[model samples]
Target chain A: MNENNSNTNLSSVVSNRAWRQSAPWIAGAAMAAFGLSRRSKSGLALAAAGGALAYAGWRANTSESDQFLARGSVLLNCSPQEAYQRYRNFEDLPKFMFHLESVTKIGERQYRWVALGPVGIPIQWDAEIVDERENEFISWRSLPGSELTAAGSVRFEKAPSGRGTILTAITHFDHPAGKLGYAVAKLFGKVPNFVMQQDLRRFKALIEAGEIATTEGQPHGPRSLKAAALKLADPDRPLARSAPMSEILKQQRRTA
Target chain B: MKAVCWMGTNKMSVENVPDPKILNPRDAIVRITSTCICGSDLHLYNGLIPTMEQGDIMGHEFMGEVVETGSAVQPEKLKVGDRVVVPFTIACGRCFFCQQKLWSCCENSNPNYWIAEKMMGYSPSGLFGYTHMMGGYAGGQAQYARVPFADVGPLKIPQGIPDDKVVFLSDIFPTGYFGAVNCDIKRGDTVAIWGCGPVGQFAIRSAFMLGAERVIAIDRFSYRLEMAEQGGAETINYEEVDDVVQTLKDMTANVGPDSCMDAVGMEAHGDNPMYALDRVKQAFKLETDRPIVLRQCIQACRKGGTVSVPGVYSGFADTIPMGAFMNKGLTMKTGQTHMMNFMQPLLQRIEKGEIDPSFVISHRMPIDSAPQMYKTFRDKQDRCTKVVLDPWATATAA
Candidate 1:
């Protein structure tokens, strides 16, 4: 309960993406405006403190923020019952969610999750399943005061003609709308919608097939520097593709 | 262990990398004896495919001795010291696609499914040393390499059958067979094929084996044309002939062949303006594939006939004659060869003396010469059809 109050206080201060960047300047400008109105020394100081606190509270609460929601859905060729049964096992999340390193079932309804945040930073938190509607719906939220604040839910529904199950996942982060790939930007060259969609893809693969397909531990050549460079370059490419073939050939020959 | 690594486009190197160990439960470590540079690998060399990172080990067609086996690899399926030919396409035997004999379409194989799904809707099976879009598993160009889904994909070779006899089962021979099978041959039906590369050579023989009445093979190189002719195909030097499609039509009495197969894919060569445009567009990243051969195959195919593509197309192609394809009521059949489905049957054919897949090999070199061999194969140097690499061979052999 105390944690929840601290979260509310911190969120009001840290909620706005614009505020995080521009708050100091905004506070200074407001202080200058208040200074001009004060006639005495103590009066100005007290008024300055009060005004600063009040404006911060007002701006933090009033700014449009923290409604960042990420979502994706996939059509899995399996029954909803099987899909639900498999997904609710939080430990298996690492199998599909690429950035998610591990999820440990701590209690009947709770899980301790460790995930790689932006730039592959390890961020761990505790979350609990808040709601369930057997074979149809499940929801979870991170505990109060966690470094990364997020809530997520999943839904499973049977499709027509016995085709399969439709699985939808939604995650809401304590971030502004523009930073859609905020948390997972580094691991997937900025991923949130795409990552969630890929997560659901692996979940679909896992349900229809017996294993989550992966090449994580497989061998490749010594490509330490190039992989990192490619990750950095992906977001800047004008088109979706890169390195034209003919240019690549000419470049290779020149280098060779 | 020394392995062939693709450092960049058109760049291949033999690097001493650490030996591979079993990565998955069904994985096996193959001490590679013979691995070949595939024509499809040229697609990668030319940077036509996406998701290939620098320093990715390169080679998909290989045969070797099993040195180690994962815990889940059953003794009945595979064991240490077993001589085996590993199929390029990885498959989990339990997948729905694998159970139905669509081994190349096995959903459980590709780990990087999302990348492929972004391009091809659904990913097919993972392939060794291909691209990350196709599972990006380290290829068998190395001396010792990992083989995943080992129980499902590797076929054991008997002692009497030499590595040369059965090694092609790993990819091209079966791939060529699959291309021929794609033709849906009615016995005595004439089938026209484009590009008489190694796979095309195999396709020529496979077409005859599948009862093709007459096989028309097209390519510019004489050595390749000679090999296809040796395979009992009536060859055409596409560069020598003006309007090769018309020549094909005239040869077929203006009716065209019953089936047309494009053994060439993205990097198709032609002596025309359309081909030049394809190169420029591909160079400028305007189109991802040069589909000149494909256009010809579709144009030259008889009405209601099938166009079979055994070649690899990485991404988009422009100016395909869809009007010719659709208005003529033609059908198209193509896929990465479901390698496991054909490896065993083709191996049996080799055992029975019906076919010696080794006839396709024009050069045998040590792995260290891979960088030059890649160029040799790419440029068709010294009449190179297919070059087999012995990973164990030392530098002096070159």
Candidate 2:
């Protein structure tokens, strides 16, 4: 048990070190893209900064294993208690989490989760909640020998301004297909930070607005660049808004 | 339904497309009675703005009767058969920005908020029929449009007011008023306005209303200048004048105007070599906007004065003269107008006969002629200043 605990501690240190070096590279890339599109003189400077940061990050990650951590935080218009209560309920995750198939409680503090993998394939994992602090935090890790090795924690605390609670979600996972899968997901805009942020936004929407509002199906003004290109391949294919039934039903109830 | 669809750069067609339906709970289906080709729409027609996909319906200034209301729409506020003018800025009133009356910066309205936030540091409110970056909500230039946040944006028109008089309230009128308001014009102040287009004409009038002693309107087009004159402003023909800056300085005792407004946004014309540079760069997608008017506005405003820009700039403008702007201690204010803030007051102005807003309308045509009219309006042909379309009208053969 002591050896296993030391191993987990060593891995956490390595993951933290990787993130400390990589976060700037991610931010720099986003800035460089923005600057280029704006055509500002500063864009070149941003690109240089991004290139340097990416190089530094690559060097830092070369010393570590194929594991990474992504952390995101959002202010919700609710108390810390409420935020913790909702997050502690494993069954409620799929409601606000996209691409999650199901999270079923198996035993005391143990749950089995099914999620959509990279290419629409179903992937399953069993997790056990290792630690939980009431109205504050919950930590969980995938059971040994599971399909995927992952761990995460949800922390809730009052915001500095006293306006509401700040919920921070920290996820640590190994890409199933290793570094290649991670790169592909990042290119396709499903980067860990982006996914976490989106999930937090949906959680905010769900808690504050009762549902995530969408313009899907009803009508859209224009096709996004990628969607427009895809139209060239399948000329007659109809575009969908990609809104799920939960969101549709929520909108229906509001309208009715 | 016959809707105006953007085909490509400098191409448009009145095509038959599927009618818009209520996709959101807060939506309402409006049967468009009248829609106008805005000066900003010319940017889309000229392919100046990016993220414009084929078949994107264009036209932000419009009004019509509410044909259907979603369940979330309050029947007391908006109902079927009720005439209303929808604000071009789509805002969900519950957001933190909206509560402060900054309707254009609403957070929850833009579904494409990620794209907008990627370009701009943060996304503003969604706009009807603008671009994919602004929620990509279908615009009101067709027979029918689905208006999201209908409960917040659509202002009901009282009996006796014609569509022409009230439709401007949707965009240009409020935009011009906001531009003038942003100028912070003091009593007996001189305001110089660029581009005597509809927004400029309204800005000229709105400047006077805000106690500007004189508004010197600049443009290359004589007809638009004439409209500016009709709105009671002195005019400067930049095409005829060698030095617009010297002319404005001479007109203002060499102090320049107290506040200068740029009503012409992305596609500005000037005799300077920089304008040519912008054209070449824009043609090659090297730059997104021609910053001539912004440059001129900063240069022409008095030291420690305001530069109010109601013009829509999609992307970065080159050679902005930041040194001059900083050294002069000039203040700049620019944004998509928060129309909800001024709609009621401006509606009262029209009701009191303070000004006839429809005086700027130069052509009324059927929607079928939208394709040709887009060119005519962009080229400033046939004395056209603004073109209003009757969506249901049968066009006379060309």
Candidate 3:
């Protein structure tokens, strides 16, 4: 009975796929005839064209054979070395990715990203930089156990209209449930993409807006009050206020 | 895209409008199946509620199936096919209020991000399809609605319970339950519920379920009074009675009720004929002494009794006799219903077949007939207690 059920399921899947592939043509023909009656031949033609375009877009956007193909690109105003300083450090990605609360660098190329999940669940993702080139391109694959396992890349290219670089991100993941999973991923993924995209733009703004990198290669020490104040003003500072003034006052009073 | 819009005072219409879509990752587009004209909506329908814009979608009580959701939304918990009953209030679970379990006042709860602060009052968050001051999120009284904070606001329907039975739980049921809970209704306590509207009816019933020995429901509407009686409440029609407070005190052996629930909220009509003119004038001027019931509740409650107010109040400028309240040593607990906290327990009760709240629903019509239903309900005609609007119905054949 189990074998029969499996066979039935497989056959049904095949039949469904066949029907889906043919549905557009049938719909197009019907729409074309109806469009002619309504003096909307152009509408019918447009409908057919739209269907073709949509199908092509879907195919191009998805992976036919799930061999973990992911691609992404990012544009930056800074040079490759400056961009590499930020991008190479996986732990610091959370600084830009607001949704990502923390990223723990476990190994040279591996990291664990802790992100806020729906209904208060902490979603954890294990990722590894599968491919890396000095500063032009970096690709990573998320390890299994996530709601989704994705492979993506970030590439830096010259901006089409200007001097600043154009950053492009492209990713392809195995959407198991096909349309349903694809739809779900599109919905949820947009938020992180938006945050990351905005961060990239901000990074470009920071670089082009002429921010001096002062802490580079400096020994970790208690920063001066002026330096601390400047650091406090950084938008990337997690907490709005670092330490309470009362605590500072109390410390000063005790020292006195 | 069909929406029941509050055009002006005593003017409302169901008109075609743009379909709502998922504009943010925290948003979900729901194809509304069941939406209802709420009593609070009548405040806008009659232009009593302030800051209402023309073509504003009215009616908040609703249930729908998720058609689309934002990327940040959880598909596992809420999928496209899952049917859900959404609270009137929108809330983002991560916000200050949500972290404190005060989902009704979430900071990031508005659908229109531009009007986030101005959408609702200083309270910050509230129901969809309300006025400009209450999130201005087009209400569920339409073919489609964009539910912000879907994971937090939209609750999954438990299997086996009919839609009508559990529909009231979305707002009134939970509000009433909150009232009973807030009153600290102990087993065998005598409870009094003010105003026998749908909420009052539920409060009376819920008080009984919560172990109130005697639930006295006060109202002038005979039909509502009958509803309360059927729901196991001893009815007191104030129209036929001389003094409702005295009558309630008489029932409670001169000590008054152990607890009193003010279910009337902000738009409660005054019981006295002399006060009716003032009440109408106040309602028109956006100044309401709905607190008369509140004062009555305080006066009618026994010393050390509790008063639970689940009614909506905003832009407060009312003086209650705090000295009298203090002397009486009564506990006053009032706020929005934390529906999420009570949903599971309520769902359990429904699952056990212990409560059937569909008795409040007096009219069920197509969504397009909402304007007519709203008028009927507003006028309190045809004994329309509660009207449920079905969005799937085809527009009336011209």
- Over B124-178, each residue of candidate 2 has an lDDT whose tens digit, in order, gives 8888778666877778889998888889999999978999999999999999999
Highest-scoring model, DockQ: 1
lDDT of 2 by residue, A173-239 (tens): 5545643333322221223565677678778766654456566664433445766754554332233
Off by over 4 Å in 2: A1-65, A75-92, A105-111, A118-120, A128-136, A160-165, A177-190, A207-213, A219-256
- What ranking of all candidate models by lDDT puts the best one first? 1, 2, 3
The lDDT, on a scale of 0 to 1, for candidate 1 is 0.77
Q: For model 3, give the RMSD to the true fold.
A: 24.8
Please give the lDDT score at residue A117 for candidate 3. Answer: 40
**Pairs in steric clash, model 1:** none
Please, what are the lDDT tens digits per residue for candidate 3 over residues B175-263? 88888889899898999988888888878878888898999998888898898898889988877888888999788779889998888
Query: Candidate 2: lDDT of B306?
Result: 99
Q: Would you list the rank order by DockQ, best first?
A: 1, 2, 3
CAPRI band of model 2? incorrect
CA deviation > 4 Å runs, candidate 1: A1-64, A74-82, A98-130, A141-150, A158-165, A176-190, A204-212, A217-219, A222-256
Q: DockQ of candidates 1 onward, in order?
A: 0.22, 0.16, 0.01
